[model samples]
Target: MPLYENRINALNTIEIDQNLLKEVQVGNQSVAKTLVDKIIENKATKIAIEGWYGVDFKKIFNLIKEEAEKHNLTVTGKSSAGLYKSSEEIAQYSAKYLTDDPSFGWVNSDGHLRDLLNPKALQELRDLKSESDLLVVYGPGVAVEELSDLYDLVIYADYTMQPMLWQMWDGELIPFGSDEPDKNYFWKQYYYNDFYLLYRQKQYAYTKTDFYIDAVVPEELKLMSFKAYEAMIDEMVKYPIKQVKIMQPGPWGAYRYRDLWDIKGLECNAWNELAGIELSILIDIGLEKPINILTQNIMQRPLELVGEYVHKTFPELFPLQVWLDDGYFPEPVPWERSSMPIHNHPSTQYVQRHFNEPLGRYETYYIVESYKGSSTWMGYKEDADLEEWERLCRDSDNLKVIPNWEDFIKRWDTNVGDLFLIPPGTTHGHGGNQMILEMDTGPSIAGTEYSFFTYDFARNTWDDNTKTMTAKQMKMHLEHSFDNQKWIREGRVRSHHRPRPITQAGDGKYRYDQYETIDEMPFHIERIFMEEEAPGDTQGKFMQIVTLTEGERVTIVSKRDPRLRTTIDRLQACVIPASFGEHTYYNESGRHAMVVILRLKKG
Candidate 1:
């Protein structure tokens, strides 16, 4: 196929109107508004997912697979890599591999996206773009910063700045000459990018290099570069975004493919932070071209306007907090993972031993108390970490405290038997004994310096050059829970389960909003079953908990006394938020079969 033909084909497939985009009305909010709105108007959806993990990346992989099979745009390029024009992308890469690190063989630090993009993977992404029309580019950061430039990169700098691609997106250049990342942008791998994508395998700053983490660099170019990494993360952390809204904007017109009921605003800040800092670098590199102007304008647009428009267009953008993943498990060793090799990290060691793999399975449960008012509490101001264990040998005031079951179960509807994966989408509450399932946003293991680390049984030092274990690696290993990467910006959501809705029935003397004589919220339920196998009554004047499973029942014994209130148990099924009362399930009746109780709030 011809060059323009391919470009036009790619553009046409995503249905983006390349009909000479509107130029900005200088110094006008309306122009910015129009630009932002235009992206949404075209039904554009800007999504960010760190696709490093093989399994998680499979989600997009599958989407591309299905789309490519249908689109037939699966043609191999000139290099069998990609024929993507230079003008099409900002950069490319050349990978270098080491004998020791074989899992991810090629590590590219500079030049060309093709050098890093395996032909097959790009084909899959392109195929998806054909059917979906969503321009999916691997980020530019990977190529620049010692990792695979798998996706197109977009960084967010602090000053009103942006890169070439973004300048083109907005049609302007950055006015302020804030050329580089400052000290505010640098981070110790000790923090571990909040341990999301790097998984539970390694620590934040434990790169097999010669620099001590705390070794100071006089404000030099290298120092500025180090800070640039920090800057990238900071930007993504604060940019307001809604995950659910990322896929859809505007109305369904008459019909929509999926329901957007669970409108959430929770953000996976990992991408946000990374993008913020990365955008800074791009703006720095793209100072001269036409793109420099446009990208700057796009990034400079304030967050208030963007947030407002999104709220106006999508109802779910407000009060949204269903962030599904956060890969934070700070470690000191590159390969020391949560569940992989269980250690005596004092606090979490017991839990790890109990649920350690082969013998235990990861359990799933619902989070009951994540909501604070309307929005979810995303900021981990109260970070949980394993403290230094004084000794089992001496019990003065120094026994390291283990994370409690109460902490784990209080937020969600959880069971005791559950195990959790670490690094990405991990909750500190669920930081129990299970092989740490390490999966983080970026590949740098230096992001996991927060929340927890592997406890060293005997003191040892970590090597500066080897990024490996030494004596310090041993001292830092005991009690092993230093969670400094809290600022990594990856959104780690605490999760739980929910029961179906319970409302008032007709002719039961109780009307939903107006007829109920009494009201309640939570309850302890006990289920009396005729047989464990019996299909409990879905019909009747019985208070019960129902699952889509095989059985149903409810039973609660109350400790509180009911004054003159007549208990309403005559209807086929009626719900009392709390099962009668605390410690008592007395209904003036005995042993009601198929009875289950629950706690709920109705709007």
Candidate 2:
């Protein structure tokens, strides 16, 4: 029997304070009103408000002052006087000290404002202290150690970090275009490192601020007190959640899948990556302003979210990351397109020794869509020549060298129902002209693509202008590829990599197709085909990552709470929390539906 089978309220073990949690709301009008009420209660004669860019502290302060005056209290508002400058200003500094990229003005990777606050600004803050009854210092610089002595209470109002494809610039969601100001600035700062810096800053802020609130929900600023906010995380961990999709351009990207999902105006190359699975979840607490937070952050409390047993086994992170890799080939190809870069991830020992990763990547591709001549590259010929392959890998470092891959690499003619397991150290790539739903272990913490690229078919990535920037990836690829090679014959490969159907529940309503995702990897994947509908229970054992691979729409209804149901469309994914005990999936579209489910191995 599952350990949690009788522990229905496993989450209730963690204590939380509702009143304290409500103090620090996410950014909302209530924040201003709350401050006003506080000032009135204290009967303070003076008050000052301070914060960072994007937030009009001056305007918000004025509104708070207006409310305070009704109670005959005098209030003053001043924006933080510190290293508050625009990206353009930071660009000028970068040009002087960092990169020569003309577009370097858009880089925010270096959090320099903390170190560059002017002396005059500090004096102005000191001056405000003598004139106000209450000083509310808030903004990006408020948490800086240098400005520690300037405020009575520091409320950090921040938005969720915008995805790389889009950013909140001056209150507008702007695409990272190849223009002067918006130029592909990310490449200049170095893609993964910049993201790491942002992650570090976010993690660091919790220690710096007296309180914090998520200001992401537009027009609905809910200030959740830091204690309450952190405590409220229990609510998020125990609920079924969906990750907002993040789409980016890839050389093999096609618009058919993107259009099908109503994701417009993207360079639809690839949907997600094996490593870069930094996903966000919308915290729907039956509130008007739902909070959006990173799944990594929630899973940091794995015991609360995934259960104590799973947490002890895999601490601080969710083990799985599933995404779609869509590729298209027009009838008459304009440019030569080949399969995904022939590559393989590092072994568990190799990843731990080299990259300090908790687990090595292991992925399974379930084919959802296939076109003419669609295939996948897996394994290698029994007699493949490594001496010749090394010569080609070295020679093609700077030149276009095409080799007869079929003579050396094994191939599999794929169809819509095919499933392929891609274990670490296995050479595999999705052949063009097919859309594959890839379910894999989460990426390394460093967010670096662990799959070492062996051959690119002499092709370039979708972003040609950033070729100079991407050239850096090749050096890492060359270093990791040589020593991890594993070649296999047809018979050996067939025994391990082939897909097969598993026994389904005898309800006669659904069938299950399972795959052994790499030998001894502690996880397995199966696809459930709902002819009409199907009912099953987690048995309080494990969490399941369910993706609606093929169906117009399907509703997952909780037998415990029918009102707490969610509908997922085709090609979308959602997590079924382990505590969501008994549930039933209904084919709301009145047709056959396919749901690919991924779960950890039972003890």
Task: Encode model 1's per-residue lDDT on 352-437: one tens digit a residue.
Answer: 23211111111112221121111111213234322322232122212232233122112322222122222221223322111111
Stretches > 4 Å off in candidate 1: 1-20, 24-185, 188-322, 326-603
lDDT for each residue of candidate 2 in 137-188, tens digit (9 for 90 to 100):
5444444555555444555555433333234322233211111234334443
Best-matching candidate per TM-score:
2
Query: Which numbered prediction scores highest in lDDT against the true structure?
Result: 2
Model 1: ten consecutive residues of lowest lDDT: 1-10
TM-score of each: 0.20, 0.74
Candidate 2, residue 527: the lDDT equals: 76
Query: What do the candidate models score in CA lDDT, each in turn?
Result: 0.22, 0.58
Query: How many clashes show up in model 2?
Result: 22
Q: Please state the error at residue 477 of candidate 2 in Å.
A: 1.3
